[model samples]
Target chain A: MEQTTIRFTLNDRPITHAAMPYRTLLEVLRDDLGLTGSKEGCGTGDCGACTLLLDGKPVTSCLVLAAEADGRKVTTVEGLAKDGKLTPVQVAFIRYGGLQCGICTSGFIVAAHALLESNKTPSEADVRAAIGGNLCRCTGYDKIVRAILAAAYDEGELVDESASMPVMEKPLFTEGPM
Target chain B: MRSFKYYAATSWEDAVAMLSKNAAAQVIAGGSDLLGWIKDDLNGPGAPRADLLIDIRTIPNTSYVKFDAAGGLKLGALTPLVTVAESADVLKNYPGLAKSALSPASPAIRNVGSIAGNLMQRPRCWYLRGKDFACYKKGGDFCFAVTGENQYHAILEGELCYIVHPSDTAPALIALNASAKVVGPGGAKDVALDKFFIGPRTNVLKETVLEHNELLAEISVPAPAANWKSAFIKVTQRDVYDFAVVSVAVAGQIEGGVWKDGRVVLGGVAPTPYRATAAEDALKGQKIDEKSARNAGDLTLVKARPMSQNAYKVDIAKNLIARAVLSLASA
Candidate 1:
């Protein structure tokens, strides 16, 4: 396959790079662009380690071709934070310790970010359904669910009268690189 | 994955021209299934990898869902599974399809998997997917699942192979009586959803009847009639993001607990979406109660020949079919 010049908006910035047609987005992001935040647990779509937002929807980056980026907007885990301020989801993960091995954290954060953006106040079922694609074998999904609920609460997105409310708390060692 | 030449097709006609020009060319809509298939190197029956890929997603006006009350629903081949799952019109008319669309892999997969891609998905046989096996589905000497790990193999139509079709939406679409539009080098033609799939007895190399030079263009589903209710039930190994063990999709016209002519399509039990005509025939003009529904399920699997390990699937299918019918009847 002939290598073509691929152009797309990545993390709110326009990018252009020469890439082969058979190369995947995850490969180009990690190798060429130095955006190594996204990990590749499985090259296939079964594992959600290489998830990113394509046009505001969570899609497995490993399955998407580089050319399909497609002249469209792409959002990786690095794009979630602004300046030095962390998003509620990220902070909640730190405080709640939602990850164990931390390989699936970035993908979960990216997917959960899309969920919150679409639905500000999501229920527990909603949270589970949105991040269902992301697999975290280490945490058993309890703390991860708690972290997402706590994040939604801190973001003022959780406003349900029937479900139990999660209280936000401060945890030690808040300053860290994900 | 093998390296392949790529061309961004501008239109349907251009895509056809590109496909017709290259013998090893294949059109890609979503790339979700195709990329994974390429990565796995599972070319069904030892077909060569597509050396040239024609990206039809670059073709405009191909990703849309048009709904008309009288004329029914028309979905472009490029329409994403998430779009179909969340469409207001589809949910209103055919909630079973929405459920089936959402029932695959997960939200991420559903968000990008196209309608035609879903229908054209290959079998999920472990022997076929793995490169080391090279089973019968991959044109090897023998089918490994016959005497080795036949847990997930087909229970009904295991002729020379024991592979089960992996498309959840196909059963729902077949129950809804959908038709697919195919555009090839010759011209365009419509194929009924049930007739579109080819079993292992007919040809194990290809799942759909589409030729190498053809591509699915659109899917059209007839509108539901008055007092029509439909539902889908899928028995999976896991709670979410798993393939069906035994899935049932039921659509019929029922009034006051009396069910008329209905359609029952089963997935994860055969090489194609197997229609339970015996169940449909037995349920005609009958009251859809627990007993009647159970009887219908029995009739559906009356001639099923279960494999050694997959005989459990027969029970699961029977229970699922009755549950599906009862759910719709109660609705």
Candidate 2:
């Protein structure tokens, strides 16, 4: 049960942590490094909610040991944007209603980003195959697939107005005594 | 998961030495299969714990897919399944291998699952996998699948245990006449893929013939003949990301549009990848037609002894064998 120091690049920054040998990359990222973008729907590899880029390829971080990422580059969902500007996939998700409830949003964005980076013009089948590992319960995947296709075809300009509705000012439980 | 000491082996010799010295240690390359077993606690509470894990993924020269005139097609033990499925040489020469590699699990799992790890994966029998049941595979007195749910149990070769080998690529490898290069403290040795798998009668505790101290170094597949055609067909409950209920792989040389010689291997049917030698013999001099393909299918399943609930698998296996052979014949 000894802890070992592992040095790896995370979110474009170098990080070193003393972690147990059995600690998964998902655990180290969420617990140790405070990068909780990647969610663990299933600790096993069945659910791809823990998907992240390991040296540019998407893999379930929950199944990957932290030590395996030593000296390697890992990119989580938080690393998708730069300088406060969202990536095309992220913007398209907002413009196309790619998510609901938002539990599996980060994984979908990361996976779609990796796919678009490799394939500029992914067909509907290609997009489906790319995100085949990721599972989303609420959105039913239609909006998510369309969002990715929109991003691939640079059609983010056709924004869905309901996706960015303004928040109300008043709180629902105003001054109610408990 | 239980804690274990981890060592990143830099060379093949060091990895083998580590395994040889520690009998309870296990090698982790890709770790897709081992981690799942560890999480599920398949090793019983009283069983010996895995004290050491030799991480061999860092070792150089152990992750390449090379093809040469002397070696034919060599896949390093650590080569990823996706790499094997996507390799141009593998796709062109050994389409059955490509199909098998691509058939298992999903894209993400294939991205990290190693070829050796796939071959070494344990059976997916729920009775053996779950902690509640004590099947014969876990050293119990009886196998629950014999009279239990028995739907997914083996039908062809279920003497003591009915656990089917869960690997998709293994059948294709066997049909292609591949050999595994194993290294241990003694030295290196080559084992045929057909003989690599050990049945429950041979050793009820393990799957492959790999000793605890040995490491599968590489898998080398013989080059197909000039007119060789190959195909793999798998029937699964779900279209994607599910294990095969019945799978068949066919590889043979077709001369003048007639079948000459070939190997037909069935997966998800028995303890090992079941090679249909009788079916192969049936197709030796026959033309690749519907009648001949159906005859090969019938001959393949002639000896299948189906369980109470798994009688349907026999028919499924036969149909898959026919479809696989017919596809190869027309290729």
Give the candidate number with the greatest lDDT: 1
lDDT of 2 by residue, B234-313 (tens): 99887667888999988998988789998999999998889999899999988988899989999878899999999999
Worst 10 residues of 2 chain B by lDDT: B42-51
Q: Write the per-residue lDDT of candidate 1 for residues B182-252, one digit (tens) a residue.
A: 99877899999989998878987777888877889999999889988889889999887999999999999
DockQ of 2: 0.57
Instruction: Give the clash count for each candidate.
Output: 0, 0
- Where does candidate 1 stray beyond 4 Å? A156-178, B43-46
Query: Per-residue error at B167 for model 2, in Å?
Result: 0.9
**Candidate 2 pairs with clashing backbones:** none
lDDT tens per residue, model 2, A59-176: 9998999999999999999998877668878877876678888888998899899998889999989998888888888987888987798788864453333445433333222343
Q: What is the lDDT of residue A132 in candidate 2?
A: 84
Please provide, for model 1 over A96-172, each residue's C-alpha lDDT reduced to its tens digit, 9 standing for 90 to 100: 77898899999999988999899878998999988888899898887887778777776554233223335533432
TM-score of chain A of each: 0.86, 0.87
Evaluated against the true chain A, what TM-score does chain A of model 1 have?
A: 0.86
C-alpha positional error of residue B211 in candidate 2 after TM-score superposition, expressed in Å: 0.7
